[model samples]
Target: MWKWETEEHAKAVVVIIHSAFEHHRWYAWLIEKLRVEGYHVVMGDLPGHGEEGKYSRIHDETVNEYIKYIKNLMESALSYELPVYMIGHGLGGTLAVHYLKKNKVACAGVILSSPWFALQKHGSLIKSALANLGSLTSNMKLTLDINKKALTNNLQGYQEMDDNLVYKTNVTVSWYKEIQLIMKNLFVPSTSQLAIPILLMTAKQDKITDVEQARKWLLLQSSTEFQFKEWPLSYHNLFHDLEREQVFMYVRDFINNTTRGLGYIID
Candidate 1:
């Protein structure tokens, strides 16, 4: 787990959820950016991810059980008694969406950066079938093939991603299946069911998640308190891209304006 607290009480607590095959510290830059803006932040790696992402080797389980781990993390942040907001990237962002759907907690808002709401445009149907089959396999240790280069266009970001201690070049097949299940469930629910504020971001050049699908979801969503932005020059790692300043500004202002007065400025 990773956390940063402001000197005084934070105006709002922002829980960060990292993308696949990466730990919370992958969000170090973003966390400090939010911390300077007076928001408390907490995040960690998911199972089979960081060195300590998993507490123990658990018995074989389904996707719902895997989601429970993130649910517990969300609950821990809510215990702070401050307005809770989520900043999730990629597959983690998808988890945040599912969390809000299954539970009716008073989440202040959610900011999704390249949420994995759907698979890549290529081989999506085949991937879905394979992932679904992988889900039911008794082999819990199976690994899924992944393309790391698609994460970011920045060379330094890729270097750091490779240097990370627990980084896995590929994720478990079960994890892929879980993501497939999440995306399906996420799309099946009525957009009208959402009640909290939502900030959905799409990476214009993302090769992993489908930006068009995310746009359609945002268009159909019922929450009038929502905002959307598409980073035209960014890759999958929006926070670590050359246009990161713009990404940070959107997040900082969203939290600041949502919890406090609307003093957000762009330009």
Candidate 2:
């Protein structure tokens, strides 16, 4: 885990959870932005990802492992004695949901960026059958064909991500199965409402996850305060896209609003 303390008097701690196949390093831009805004940043790689994935690829990862990882980060963030907020991207967003459901942490709010509750594309029947069969073996690997261009429109950001060696594009059968199970339970009626304030953002042109599903999920939420915004021209990675400055502004506004609502004064 890594923590970036704000040079100014910190207003709150923001725990960032990155998307699948990516690592904490990819969030340098966001981390610095939050720090500059007087918010401490804490983030790290999930199990079987980033540095760990470099040595051993994703295999046999369980849902409990992901939840536990985020729980530890949340605990660390809470140690600052400031309001703790969570920003999760893609699969990380889904993991955040699972973590919140299982653990009763003192979180100020949450922001989900294009959460992976459902995929944009479903596999063919044959491929689905193979994946189900492979789940029985649990160790079978599948190389994901992710389109870097579809993630962000900024040429420089796209180039940097494409050249990054830490990103993993492979997933094991068990890992896929685990994620599928989590997605299935994400919107169950019994646990649909999250008491904390929520900000759900989606890219209209996102090709990685289903935007409609994300919208549907947001509508189902019964949070005390919830907001949904769809970026018309952005792709999957809203923070890395061309309109990142605007996206950051929205995040800042959300934090500001939530903090104020909680009777916390922000300097």
TM-score of 2: 0.93
Which residue pairs does candidate 1 place in steric collision? none
| lDDT on C-alpha atoms for all candidate structures | 0.72, 0.84
The sequence of per-residue lDDT tens digits that candidate 2 reaches over residues 135-228 is: 3566767655565777998886676566445565677666777787788888788753677999999998898898888888877777869889
lDDT of 2 at 210: 86
Q: Write the per-residue lDDT of candidate 1 for residues 114-159, one digit (tens) a residue.
A: 9988866432236556546644554444443345677788877676
lDDT of 1: 0.72
Model 1 spans with C-alpha error above 4 angstroms: 53-62, 121-145, 164-166, 169-174, 189-192, 261-267
Question: In candidate 1, residue 266 scores what lDDT?
Answer: 22
